[model samples]
Target: MEKPSPSRRAFLGLSAASLAGLSGCLGSLSTETDETPGGNTSDTDPNDGNETDSDNETHEEPTEPPGLPEGGAVMFVYDDGPMEDYTQALPAHRTFDAPATVGIVSEWIGREDYQSSGCMDIEHLEELVDAGWEIASHTSEHTTLGTFELVEDAAPGAERIYPEEIRHGYHRGKTIELTSDEHTFTRAVADYGSDDTGGYIAVDEPIEEACLAGETIIRYPAEKIREAMGDSKHALEGMGFEVETLLAPYDNFDDYSRKFASEYYSGVANARHGKRVNDPEGFDPYRTRRDYFIEYTDRESVKRDLDEIAERGALGVLGAHTFKEEVTEDRIRETLSWVDEREITVMTLREAIARYADR
Candidate 1:
């Protein structure tokens, strides 16, 4: 991985004047039309009440319209708080005056061992927050929030231990089911423990029947999911960044995760996939969709999605792993340029939700 050179930090100062000029141009464009590009009136009539207002009466200055552009909006979300976000992505976004949101894996920040692998430190993230970016929770340790199959079988009443190390998903007070080819047993986890070998779930009730190890373990118990959500938020907030969104690890989440997300976050990016854009009206903040920018992402397909979002006046959320080889700074710049040409507003996920989503 390439580290940020001193030259890049110097370049940021040089870009400010150009960014100011770009802002001016956009401001002028917004004021040119009485109605916005989406055909909604930008300002309301001040004297429509009587239909016979006196000429001397003072009219209230038209308040600036909402921050979202009528044409459409796009939110750039970078998952995993990697140093590249500060080193590579930030400078490119600065060139375009575009603000983004970054999902942070709480435990990874500032660990020296992880830094070699490109994990960002607290200072790096603080800079992003200062640069108009929003910090979002990716959960502690980047734990998988979705359900997975059990690797071992459990005898009646014994602690259910798995073959693989469990990073998360089990917590006291949450119910889990052990299902096999023939039997399914529901039990509340009385205790949860993990070690170098694997994770174990303790249940007060003895299993009346044995369950096959090859089958699924259903969903992650709810309390543990909440702990992941809440702990990440608290960890980030303790560092003084306001966290109001979640980008579930692996784009994996279910009703249990989504339900818990509402308690901690204002919106969720990568809440679910397969949808390109979110409807501006009545969009579910907890169910917001995202398209990933990956090694095999087709640039043309991305452009088409942006075009559709602009044409429909909907919201588009794009996710990326900035540390990857395929996600170069130049690629990020090119994408931002396309968004700029279409007159689409690039904002943080929180801003997009506040301006567009129902919640």
Candidate 2:
């Protein structure tokens, strides 16, 4: 079976593509409309209801909207941190003098499978940093944080392990990690099933019969979430990169994950697929948005997405994968060409996030 790519979902409201589908998604371009739920970016402080600055006085909101570098800002973000980026994607971006933020799976770096699968190694990631591309953590192994239905032991002090650190079991003879708390488990019970909607889940009682069923854990607990975040950030920092951003694998994260991310990352790239266009002046530093780029996405779709960003003066964050069969050189070149024609400014995630400081 072919491998699966990331799924699309909304961040705070409708996705950018879905918003585009709406009759008046961009009607009047009113900055007054708060698209994100409970996100009042006007006079409200992002930190909390306490809008007072350090001086114990109210901070004034900027009268003018924040501006992009030139025409507009278009940020291309590549996921899974594939090595082909060094050989292929990077060259294409350099062709247009564009910059991108590559989400790195820290565990995949220098691994045998990563090497064979064309995932980028540490040196390649370093080279990307040298070349001015921003490197963000795509989690330690691109592990989806909260998508598992693990059979657990209800007994206190049961065998517990971090979800991302899980290393055993098989779903239909495939190695399954991030699921049930199966410390000694090498294979799932007979009822393991996966489908188009749900990725993988236990479908029968056989899994429970094998052991006293514990509370079903979703994503990593708070501690484990912290460990994973710290591990990935440290791993990249060990490679000499000033890491401060995280791109959640599959763009999936729980509230706990977001909390821990703020401790380690300056910003996290967690957003809806089509609704990634964000205005820097009204930027949310923690819950940054992003868009997806698949092989099937046509040039018109790309142009339309960029055009939406340009028109709104929002920072368009486009995402892609390097090692997939669909991520071809020609496609990358084509996307770069679109960005070039639009005169969009290409910057790393760090550079983009810095604008929020002045805002």
Candidate 3:
């Protein structure tokens, strides 16, 4: 479920504006923050170098070995809402005996509105996991990482949502209102802070420490990226799902966020804006690429993408959402059948990571 790409004119405007704001603060932005393994709590010290080398060592990503024996690996990833899991993907997986991964926004599990006809609740997610589908984090809310505040705490008795405060993407800062102690949603509020420029900054410096100020149009500080990644992982595991992978909203990643992902998750299934054709010999686990299944006009076009993956001996990840009209149940069935006919290896993100990523 990627939002349409910004127009070239709009993108240029944003880039220009961002550069003007980032130029002056570039040097000061590299200060360090202390971090425990999973939580986002931090205390910044401009001179601290204690964690600098360790952080650098942590994000020096290595390429994964080609894990498939014959044809390249093909992972069918269902992104965003979960209703498609029960109504569509599950049946296809069961029919084809395929294993796919579903990336879910953790807080939407049981809510009524978010559980509408096309969306799935917690029980439905559990069913998917029971049927052998890997459930990965699409974050607590599907907030656009570099452009918005990822999540904010909400009081139980108060409004369940605050649409205005939530920014930049489809699911904004969500309120975690779970009733049970077993499902505590931890918010590392202290781990992130806003600069005078209104950019949400990570408390921790990236392993590279290459000041992000003027590097990208938008930047998600290393700490906030960790909070979103760590919180989502904790929430899914708290609810009893085996979580290891992350699916970035809009297939977007900044270098800092990618580094944070490498630190927290076993693998990242989607990175870059769209339809990334990966090179197997030097595939990056943190920035694993994918193409949208719905974007192809015909079966032949999809097969061509698959053929490319096979030719390159790459781990090709394909993304889809059953809720969309273009991504129908019939389409999934057709795709799976085609995959079976092609002898392509279809595995969950977890399965791929176990076989391919450098642990």
Candidate 4:
């Protein structure tokens, strides 16, 4: 099946004739909108009252709340913490401004999958935390929690491991998606090896179950993500990190997913498909995006995305992963240098969340 791209009807997906038109009309004025629920951006906050508010409650056409933060905003959420993020990308973030949060997959932190085990070291994370980079949970494993049903034994402080499900090709099943039997969301921390503290949970542990406990924000690939985030907050705390924001898997969150995470993060939610619009010849850090500038996330497409945001008065967020050899490091550097030269705020995902709260 040809899955639709995030930017359907965008420049990237436009037909040859339409694309030519778009290219010609791509002057200073053109607009596009992506209001789809699953194009990687969603509101999954937990409604914890802290993260979410009915700020736009007025009946005046219910526009975005005024007195909010400036220009709404832009931010960066680095997902998965691949080593490249640490070695190749972080310095750029630092040069611009400290990032707000760095979501990490606990299981992949020190382990290698396909030899791309995260390049970030524990020390690097520690340093980042010291440098004001808020650390948040990206799940113990990079599993799509929503799709993977919790077994009976799942419980708090008790980590449980599901058998490998079939992967993409050749029917290598890794998990089986199903509805929750109990139908209540909760957290499980299998008390891995040591109940002492800061220890890894193992596969075999008493499965303790509860209604999805944790902080509100979450990101799972299943249909009902709220339930999957159950009690995940405390579970993450047990791992020695104060759990706050929960970025979506692949940065993919729909409105529901965003509602869940907002319960805790209580700020603007992060999305994968933010836009980038800067000077074509040069770049204004205020209006530029490294991912977009590097041509990694489709710059022209992003410019159009920006136009939509400007019209809607809604917040816009842009995420970036490491630019691989495929995209070329030189391009990445050029984008970063532009941000620094322009002195853009270059806020981190967490910072944006906090700012959104103020907004």
Candidate 5:
């Protein structure tokens, strides 16, 4: 089930303080670690990179894509932890001997009636966690980690979310201004580490008026997404759920995002547009340690990704919003067929964590 909720303000304050300490050592923070892939989950690095490593140097080791055990090892993961996720996604997991993990927006569990939309319900959520799907954090709300990609993902001009009015001229009616999701989020992210100079807010709150005056792709809103991360970690752990994976809200990430995703969650899954911005594994865009980007778009694609999982020897994560209109009930069923094929071992994020930890 759910654990006692922490005070949001308190958690935010603490997280900022912690991040600050990291910034102090930021100069020497980027030093390379002896992190290596393969060798089971044992090789999974725990850096979540939550701390500031700006000063340390980074080194990339030449590694072949990781391959799974003999046949192939795959882990299925779902995001948002919504009730529909519990209702629709979990059954497929059970049929296949595969365990799953669902990341959640702590605050969105039950406020279904909120003016601003939220995520799942508590009872069904409890049922899923009790049944074995790993429950991880997606922040207090479904906020993006760092600035989101403004170019293709989001439409230009003031990303409008709600369309209500508050005596301030139709909150977002008839006016699509050019803005980034830098601070905008369904749920805000917990800005961890010691840097507290910038508090959290909507993706485009910290006005760079001069720079962002005209039409320009908005920046990813990492600050709000990372708010209360420490408290969130505590909450998840307290709920008897291990903090294991992170889903970049809409796969919105950047250099700093990768660092924290590595530091806080065991793995992170983002959309693989297949476009290498700088380099796939570069600071701007990198290989996700948690699992492979999902390919559950179709049954054939599912099979292809599964084969790739085996070929890579890395984990293949199955992701869905349960809310996506595109991923229908039928497609979900078709996707699970591959999980049952026995070619891959199905596991939850927690199970993956345990397996890796054991290794």
Candidate 6:
């Protein structure tokens, strides 16, 4: 069932000091306006329908896009809390006095297995928080929050079964539901496996009734989703860091996840993605958009998007996985330079919400 959406005041409850702090970081923005896109203005009078040669020649000066404090804003978000974020991306951003938002996987923090693979530890993340960075939740284990379907069938008491593994949504300890046209069975994942046969999930309890191979597998219930969202925020806050946002694991979430996220987070960075920028008027903090900057991403295309952002005075969000081989420090620095050259404001996702979102 869908849950009630929380109001911004109930969720953020920004105090006078908090607002002052935000204003200190991001100085005053221009008041909201009703200007059209491209800041174009029409000087022609509608009532005076008489057309003249001089009327065609007269042009109105362009103005700032509506709903921003001034010009466009960009937010750089690093996903997965990798060691490279602290080691590589931080220095690049520091060069231009820009702050970034990072989505942390709670279980991966300080875990030897993950640390060995170049994930960030608690100490590394602390340094980021100290440097004006925003720490957001990417969930406890980076579990996929979206639902997928099963590949094979099983009877009651069966503990293991095949699922469409390409989604990579299943994990041990996660509660899941198997739903068919006629019935729904909820079970906790005991283990996850992949081999020559493909990927499968091992449930803790035996299936109560027969389910076919094509049945749908729901990854989370409303209660569990709420638990995951709240627990991740609490875990980070428990570490003395302010966590007011979420970056959905695997950039995958549905209406249920969105609803629960608002209960615990002020905003979500990976809510959507594409070439478009967010409009501040009636902005939905939970549905903010972001574009990926992977190794294969085109530099020119990103520049064009930035151009549009500056021209329209909109909010542009860029997300990246800093740990990847091709996403080097130089590449990150170069992107920051682009935004710098355009004179666009770069702030953390949390700050953007505070500035642009309607409260």
- Best by the lDDT measure: 6
Give me the displacement of residue 228 in model 2, in angstroms. 1.2
Residue 9, model 4, lDDT: 19
Least accurate 10 contiguous residues by lDDT in model 1: 8-17
lDDT of 1 at 200: 67
Q: In angstroms, how far off is 336's CA in candidate 1?
A: 1.0
- What overall lDDT, based on C-alpha atoms, would model 3 receive against the true structure? 0.58
Q: What local distance difference test score does each model get?
A: 0.71, 0.59, 0.58, 0.42, 0.45, 0.72
Best by TM-score: 6
Model 3 spans with C-alpha error above 4 angstroms: 1-67, 115-118, 147-216, 220-222
TM-score of every model? 0.69, 0.64, 0.62, 0.48, 0.54, 0.73
Global CA lDDT computed for model 5: 0.45
Error of 6 at 244 (Å): 0.7
Worst 10 residues of 4 by lDDT: 163-172
* Candidate ordering by lDDT (highest first): 6, 1, 2, 3, 5, 4
lDDT of 1 by residue, 25-55 (tens): 4443443332222233223454674343467
What stretches of model 2 exceed 4 Å from their correct place?
A: 1-67, 146-192, 195-217
Q: Write the per-residue lDDT of candidate 5 for residues 1-359, one digit (tens) a residue.
A: 01112331222222222433433434232323212221222222467725335556444433221112444455555766655675567675555544566777776667676332445675667777666556767765455444322222223342222211111111222112324334322322222222132211233333233223232333333443345354566666766655655655555555656656655665554534332111111221134343223343345555676776655544555566666655455666666665455355555544333233212
Instruction: Write one digit per residue (lDDT tens) for candidate 2, span 237-302.
Output: 887877777788766765546667678876766644445577767676566777666554666777
Measured with C-alpha atoms, the lDDT of residue 136 in candidate 3 is 85
